[model samples]
Target chain A: EDKVVQSPLSLVVHEGDTVTLNCSYEVTNFRSLLWYKQEKKAPTFLFMLTSSGIEKKSGRLSSILDKKELFSILNITATQTGDSAIYLCAVALGGSEKLVFGKGTKLTVNP
Target chain B: SAVISQKPSRDICQRGTSLTIQCQVDSQVTMMFWYRQQPGQSLTLIATANQGSEATYESGFVIDKFPISRPNLTFSTLTVSNMSPEDSSIYLCSVRQGALTDTQYFGPGTRLTVL
Candidate 1:
């Protein structure tokens, strides 16, 4: 079965602290891995990693994928209260449009 | 990326009643999908709505209970039939543009509260 697992289901940290969220997957013919941030409504696209060893970054948020380990990690630097949300990781299989998502990490950044 | 919108952002319905959620995309899309997210849980794909074709449902989801319609490329609807408290969840609509990559955009989602 194809599945994505994220570690540290929930985390609480103070503002300005950095956090690293982990995602590991076991799927057939993996194509890409994606990260999303959900605050209240829909999840907004954060990063999509396709090739191994290549890092995708947006401001304080960045992500990378390791095909050999079949895993990915999302790093957030200078965390803020506004960054508190559920971080979701998903893997897209080759030849399929459907995405298998992890349970998500509920991050709470305290001020 | 596609800008998707869902009607009836939130609703409270009684048991045994049914509610239909509408999803509209700003631009034409090739594929649209419906998903259910229970409180504090991950999103689960319910069905994939293809333009001018029948929706393909996932395992554990049937067409009779969760009928879907995709009359065109930019519009689709998902009807939750015979609702119950357990059916209370966030119904989301997603769309993929060209390729089968990980670039699926989602709508704000409709919050259904069955009482």
Candidate 2:
């Protein structure tokens, strides 16, 4: 069975603090890992990682994948209240478009 | 990425009733996906609707319960039949660049509350 697990189901932090969200998976025929941020309803695309070591960054948000360890991390530096949302991690099944998702980490950045 | 939209942003439905959620895309797409998000839970794929074919439902989801229709390239609809309290959830529709693409753009989602 394919499974995706995310750590720290919920977190509370102050503005200007940095936070790291974790995601690990167990699945056959690995394909790719993706991150999304859901503020209210729809989740917005964040980063998609397929190779190890290589990192993808956008502004203060960055993510990296470790295929060997079957895990990935999303880092948000200089966090602001606008960054408060539910961060979701999903892994796509190889040779298929199906994605297994984790429960997500809810981050609340207090002003 | 495509501009996706869903109708009835929020609704309160009574038990034993039914609701049909419509999904529309700004551009033509070969495939459209329907997902369900339970309260405080992750998203789950309910079915994959392809034009000119029957919708392929995932495990634990049946066509009789969640009927889907793909009439054209840019439009699809999912109907929740015989609604129950457990059927209350947020239904979202998504579309990717291609059939093999993994990145998907989502709709705002229809929040259904069954009472």
By DockQ, who's the top model here? 1
* lDDT tens readout by residue for model 2, A28-89: 98899999999889999999899999999999999999999999999999999999999999
- Single-chain TM-score of chain A, each candidate: 0.98, 0.98
Model 2 segments more than 4 A misplaced: none
TM-score of 2: 0.98
lDDT of 1 by residue, A34-73 (tens): 9999989799999999999999999999999999999999
Model 1 Cα RMSD, 1 decimal: 0.9
Docking class of 1: high
The number of residue pairs in model 1 that clash at the backbone is 0
Candidate 1 has what TM-score? 0.98
Candidate 1 regions with alpha-carbon error over 4 angstroms: none
In model 1, pairs of residues that clash are: none
Error of 2 at B115 (Å): 0.5
State the DockQ of every prediction: 0.83, 0.81
Highest lDDT among the candidates is held by which one? 1
What DockQ number belongs to candidate 2?
Answer: 0.81
